[model samples]
Target chain A: MDSIMRVTVYIKIKPEVLDPQGTAIARALSDLGFAGINKVRQGKIIEIDLDKTNAIKAVSDTESMCERLLANTIIEDYSISIGE
Target chain B: MDSIMRVTVYIKIKPEVLDPQGTAIARALSDLGFAGINKVRQGKIIEIDLDKTNAIKAVSDTESMCERLLANTIIEDYSISIGE
Candidate 1:
């Protein structure tokens, strides 16, 4: 039996980095009369389905994946969650 | 004092929607030696900072925003989480 696991990775640009999409979102919200919104930041979520069943190994692999290809560590930060 | 709240929204494509980016990511990962990864899905996260302190209102507003602009309901599903 294959021990399949799902991992969700959330990646966001560093605070200092300029996010044109986020700025555009905020402006659009204001135009839509949702003026209470103070700030908006846009990011990405990557969900990976893995064949590994071991929880610890899955997470470790996912993290390495993030470091190597999933995220740009110089300008973004990411978080990972493992699910059944 | 203004009650500020943070809301995180996760948006993903409908299962039936073709995800080229995800496919590309999976292929890239395979090229990088992470061949155990079976599938991948790519989505977006939008974090909003609201001036409204009430948790309920913050969530409601965020949902409305998602419907209006943050997400394309036609081919996507979104979930919202509120944080301090």
Candidate 2:
């Protein structure tokens, strides 16, 4: 039986990129009377369950997934974490 | 002058809720020839910069924001963290 591992990948837009969703969120907060909000940036978190035992291989595989599909490397940066 | 604080809010679908995005991600990973993937769940992260000195007030304000707009509490759950 393969050991199960949980992986978390966080993908965020590059600082130089403009995030419209973040802008909308900030405006909404202001409209709601929540003041003192300077800025807002939105990103995503993808959690995956993998049938693998080796921690090193799990991280490498997840990173590849992020590079290929999970994240748009051109405009976003992604980090991965693996857990038992 | 109000001090600056950074807040991160993570929103995820409730376990009982059907996650089509997650399903799509899983299928995509499989199509990419990466096997042994059991499940995938997708979520969002919103990073906010606040001009506030009091950490407690900042958290409360952020929580209110989450309840009002940041998250759809009926089908999603959200967690928040504040940092300097």
Candidate 3:
């Protein structure tokens, strides 16, 4: 029998890392007619699958993977979630 | 006059990019007790703001932008959506 887990992580640039995508989006917003959209930032969402007997432990391991390999802690921050 | 539109683009590997993240997730899924989860591929979601008098045109422009700049057409594919 095999088990599966779905992990989604969102990674975004540090505020200081000039976000061209965000800027472009902001400009597009102004063009579209929405006002007061002061700023925008772009990010990435990564979904992973894992096998483990314990759901809690699997999530923890995925978090560690994010911290260790998936994201650069120095310039990026990430959020993680686990599901069936 | 100002306008605003929200655009979301999802980018994924072309199935041959050797997705280590997807591989990791698949392993995690088996560990977490989910059975029959065959394959997983990791991707990114980019949200943008656009300004245009016409919603239809805005969506089209966003799609072109995705093709020209946002995504690598050779190794990636993208989907775009527009909103308020």
lDDT of 1 by residue, A27-71 (tens): 999999996787899999999999967889888888899999989
Q: In model 1 chain B, which range of ten residues has the least summed lDDT?
A: B52-61
Candidate 3 residue runs with Cα over 4 Å from true position: A15-17, A20-42, A52-55, B1-3, B20-42, B52-55
Chain B TM-score per candidate, please. Answer: 0.90, 0.93, 0.74
Cα error, candidate 3, residue A80 (Å)? 2.4
* C-alpha RMSD values across all candidates: 1.7, 1.8, 6.5
| Model 3: lDDT to the true structure | 0.69
Tell me what fraction of the real C-alpha contacts between chains A and B each candidate also makes. 0.92, 0.92, 0.30
Error of 3 at B71 (Å): 2.1
Q: Write the per-residue lDDT of candidate 3 for residues A1-84, one digit (tens) a residue.
A: 556666677787886888887788667656765544455667887766555447677667667766766678888878877762
Considering every candidate listed, which one attains the maximal lDDT?
2
Give all candidates' CA lDDT scores. 0.89, 0.92, 0.69
TM-score order, best first, reads 2, 1, 3
B1-84 per-residue lDDT for model 3 (tens digits):
556667677788886788887777767756765554456777777766554446677667667766766678888988776652
The DockQ value obtained for model 3 is 0.21
